[model samples]
Target chain A: DAGITQSPRHKVTETGTPVTLRCHQTENHRYMYWYRQDPGHGLRLIHYSYGVKDTDKGEVSDGYSVSRSKTEDFLLTLESATSSQTSVYFCAISSGVWQAKPNTFGSGTRLTVV
Target chain B: EDQVTQSPEALRLQEGESSSLNCSYTVSGLRGLFWYRQDPGKGPEFLFTLYSAGEEKEKERLKATITKKESFLHITAPKPEDSATYLCAVLASGSRLTFGEGTQLTVNP
Candidate 1:
């Protein structure tokens, strides 16, 4: 919802395989973020992009990378998926400076690494 | 480091039961505090934003209040449809939003 879309709603991959999740936004928001939801950990930010080509790591950046080649798209890549990385991933967009404004999140992509 | 901690990992209530969820936070240069609701498979939906201590906002049966150290989400006269996980997050001096382990709320009719 909120003009944000994440592809491949569900996926199961072998451990150590590379995986990429895509986030697309029609809202033209200037900020986009990738986060993972796990039991007990809550939502942990993986990466965020302030603008196209301007991406930065977040709290839980290990084993994760993100890229934004266009304003509407942000991609998160797990170089080598692990069972520990299996969780629901959410994409968020913020339309404010430094993102003080509330973020709009996508429906989430459930990724399972076997 | 900016951090947020929500209490009562899970809650269950009968229809029309009133309750509150707590989110205690510690952050330098507090920017804002936000509340969100998430269903089983969906992304979190924004509920309210509190910019400063003592500020409060309300929507439907939910009222969110904030202070310097913590925030409270009060649910009044809850219905079965109100069941969902409520998340609290805070934005401080940096660009990242730190979130707390949400409180899963179940409203039984």
Candidate 2:
């Protein structure tokens, strides 16, 4: 298993409320990514960070924001959560380019917005 | 836009049965193809990485092979422990990976 951890393994919240998920890695990988998994949708990347404070948007970045202040921590924030945002969120890390090296993933966070 | 598609959303196999899962993809510049296995309530675990067409990789009873447009994950003499969702993804030149919906495999003892 990879040294990756996602906090609040399971969470339930009301719609229109602020929600934040945390991903911490001990591997000191250079790349970290936040993705959401839904039924029939597979895994969709919301955001990614190549280095400290260097981030980029993924295909499903709308209504979500991420920040990576240090090498080990990457945070994903949903300013105002919606029912549509309810999904299983996963965090992945890679020591080198993802295409060259397989990404190690954290257990995951199951969030529900009602 | 790069896309990945997996067929037969779910599969059922008896223990010792051999089978394969398919992943078809289209990417601008192919960099690599990846296979991951996920048990219920757990994140995906990396399985294999195929770089070019005709490339093959193996681990235990699992084998992954790739071609120009698709990849296949073959399992031999599967066991109950092999039950899981198998995910396929393609990493293009930009380091972004596009994933398939996955094939849920159930091996019964």
Candidate 3:
């Protein structure tokens, strides 16, 4: 278990409403990632941060936005929620620059958009 | 696109039955391969990392072996507590890791 926490462990939001999920870490890892797990799609990377204020898009970056203004926090926002976004979101942090070491994940956040 | 595919989408084994889960990958240049176990409603827990072909690593009842194109996770005499979804991911040319759908293993007592 990593010293990572995701705020709003569970969230329920209606369609077309704005929602945000937060990931906080005390490990001070340089690399952080956000992933979404669906029923059959496995876990897909949504976005990642290499450093403070430096971020990049991942395989499934549509309909989502992330901000990492500081080293310890990363935020993911959905401008308008959709039913398709209903899934478990996981936040992970790696201590290495290129994932030389395994990444540790937080407990996760379960989000349901109706 | 770098791809990872795990076989036997679901598996059921009696306690103490040894088995192996397969993860086949195709990437431009493999930097690393990762193994993770994910319980229901929880995030994945890291297990092992295999860096190159013919590399092997082990811990407790689990063993991970890698080749050029595929990797195998061997579980020896597993217990009910070992039941979980086994996920395999690969780090390709860049740092992004691509994941497989995962193999769900259920060890019955």
| Candidate 1 residue pairs in backbone clash | none
Per-residue lDDT of model 1, residues B1-109, tens digit only = 8889998999999999999999999999888899999999999999998999999999999999998999999999999999999999998886568889999999999
* Tens-digit lDDT track of model 2 for B13-106: 9999999999999998898889999999999999998999999999999999999999999999999999999999988886578899999999
TM-scores for candidates 1 onward, in order: 0.96, 0.96, 0.96
Overall local distance difference test of candidate 2:
0.91
Clashing residue pairs in candidate 2 (N, C-alpha, C atoms within 3 angstroms): none
Error of 3 at B62 (Å): 0.4
Residue B52 in candidate 1 has what lDDT? 99
Off by over 4 Å in 2: A98-102
Q: Score the docking of each candidate (DockQ).
A: 0.75, 0.71, 0.64
Alpha-carbon local distance difference test for all models: 0.92, 0.91, 0.91
Model 2 TM-score relative to the real fold = 0.96
User: Which is better, 1 or 3, measured by DockQ?
Assistant: 1
- Displacement of residue A47 (Cα, Å) in model 2 is 0.6
Residue range A6-78, candidate 3, lDDT tens digits: 9889999999999999999999899999999987787888988889999988888999999999999999999
Q: Candidate 1's residue-wise lDDT over A4-105, tens digit each?
A: 999989999999999999999999999999989999887988888999999988889999999999999999999999999999999999998766644689
lDDT per residue as tens, model 3, B1-109: 8889999899999999999999999998999999999998788999999999999999999999999999999999999999999999998886568889999999999
